[model samples]
Target chain A: MNQLNSTQLETLRNDLKARGLSLFVLKDELLDHICCLIELEMEKGISFDEGRQIVFKNFNSAEMLRNQKKTKWIYQSKKFKRKFKSVLSAAAVIMLMMVGGVEAQETPDGHPIYGDCELASGFGIRRDPIYKIKRMHSGIDFKAKAGTPVVATADGTVLEAVSNPDGYGNKIIISHSGEYKTLFGHLSGFNVKTGDKVRKGDIIGYVGSSGRSSAPHLHYEILQGDKKINPELFISK
Target chain B: MYSKELMKGTLKTIVLKLLKEHEKMYGYEITQKVKDLTQDKIQLTEGALYPTLHKLESLGYVYTEKKEYNGRTRKYYLLTESGQAEATEKINEFAEFVLTMKFIFNSKLAAE
Candidate 1:
């Protein structure tokens, strides 16, 4: 079998690129796959172009080329979407988990509000409505009527659902993959219990003035590990 | 040629078992290895092979190691620690599935 010289390989690369095999890793693998196919064909005593013809006839489907993009996007996006549940035993080896980690970003579906809602207040320090003192707001507050259904921001397990007196009146915390936790505060009621599985946009409770609140609203907090970061980093008005 | 449906259902398990036995392999090597072992009866097309490999990689079951081969960079897939464990599970699952298939298919009429 004749080996494909560098010029022949380069020409093949351009041929594939012209046909939309531009995804780097896939293009590289296809280059190798095509080379192997051509070599195998040549082993049968066929000429180089004849072997190339066979490879092109087989691999040059529009559907196959479309897969180059679709698979790349799915892999790239899911690479960022962490689901530690399936294989937590090997999480330690995933370096991406160490750096980027799982984060609460804009969920690709309906927002946490069930019907009508607006941002009453956002993440950052502001003057306490009643106390009139500047204090840090740990989460974003959505203004909604009491008993407005509140959905989960992402897929997670209900971590806690309790009415505490000290602060955060009736609250529900859901633990997501990659150590992401979302807190829903001032709920009038809960639709989920601790350890219950919830999906993105799944209604977990009803908004209310339950905990340390002056009005009916939803206090949404996104926590990385345990630290409360800006909910706006992920959600918005 | 094998039915695409059967191949689709079995491909992940097959790829996982192959990776478990081979330790590491490039895309071409994997296709070639499977063809050789199965006597070309189960030829895996590029369309099927790549999407499966990418899905596995995204699932954290496999990781990539890039190496320059024949003046071009080739991405080699190596099973992660969890991937190896998953491979064993997949193999056993497929075995059980086959057994279940036998029980279902081999059952004769009760003469009712």
Candidate 2:
């Protein structure tokens, strides 16, 4: 592992403090990741001056910081508190069942449903490609030109496919078994409706820049129970 | 880059020495002290410093206390018992390294 000199270390320390990162709160791995990124950028023909600028640009941006802060907050949020209680309750029930020698229920398969469209934008800090200010892009954006096919990401029953003003334009939410749910947002139009049984990769809607969007794209998300894990974790690159 | 790398290698020593003398420090204050003591030769950035502090904390070499100042919360890091022992070892090691390098360089200069 490459180590930084005292001077370089000091520079890094100041930069992080300026960006509101509490040194005491940061884990070693996260710090190593940031250092690796800076080193990589430096290797990419970028001067130290330019590398620092780019690194700060990427790390200090509102979108990225917001997500980082949100992740931290989620771990300390009321929602997490409630979920923790529920998990404890469920564990107690399961333990009682086990003591009674009852077989535990089997969880359903979680094969991912492929989308019918191509990607437009990824989850991260990006200039709204339309709006100038930084916006928290909560999901992946897919390209399915207006009226082009958008498909379900998994085997699920359509919970809602309707037009609304939340800036998702026309959107759909599917609830799969095992508390796994998928959302397809910013559609130009929809081909399914509430309570509709949809198979994996089934066409459900078409992409459009609807409610609060600047252009045509589908905002996609996957949720397990109530927690939103990174959709890219499941999607094929 | 070489100088930076060398400085980084001895960071534990420098931090331990400072804490041994001053007792405790927050992130910003530590960086400032390094810069001042080095006569501006060394400048630690926040990006690199926090991670090191955290690593030290995880290793039980240091501990932290959160304090409020200027309406903002700041975490100050202090060396632990193990950290003090390790710091002494590091200082000895560094001193030996400097002496050996100086001897080698002096011999080369004399031969030339």
Best by DockQ: 1
CAPRI docking class of candidate 2: incorrect
lDDT digits (tens) for residues A41-102 of candidate 1 = 99999988898898898874587677777797876678545554446646655656554544
TM-score against native, each model: 0.55, 0.36
DockQ of each: 0.38, 0.05
For model 1 the TM-score comes to: 0.55
Which residue pairs in model 1 clash with each other?
A169-A211
TM-score of chain A of each: 0.55, 0.48
lDDT of 2 at B25: 86
Q: A1-237, model 2: which lDDT tens digit per residue? A: 333445665576667666666423453333443555566687777665676778777664354345446445543464576788899999999899876542222122322223356666777667776578787676777765666677776677888888888767787988876567888788887889899998777788877778878777678877777876567777642
**What is the alpha-carbon lDDT of model 1 when measured against the actual structure?**
0.83
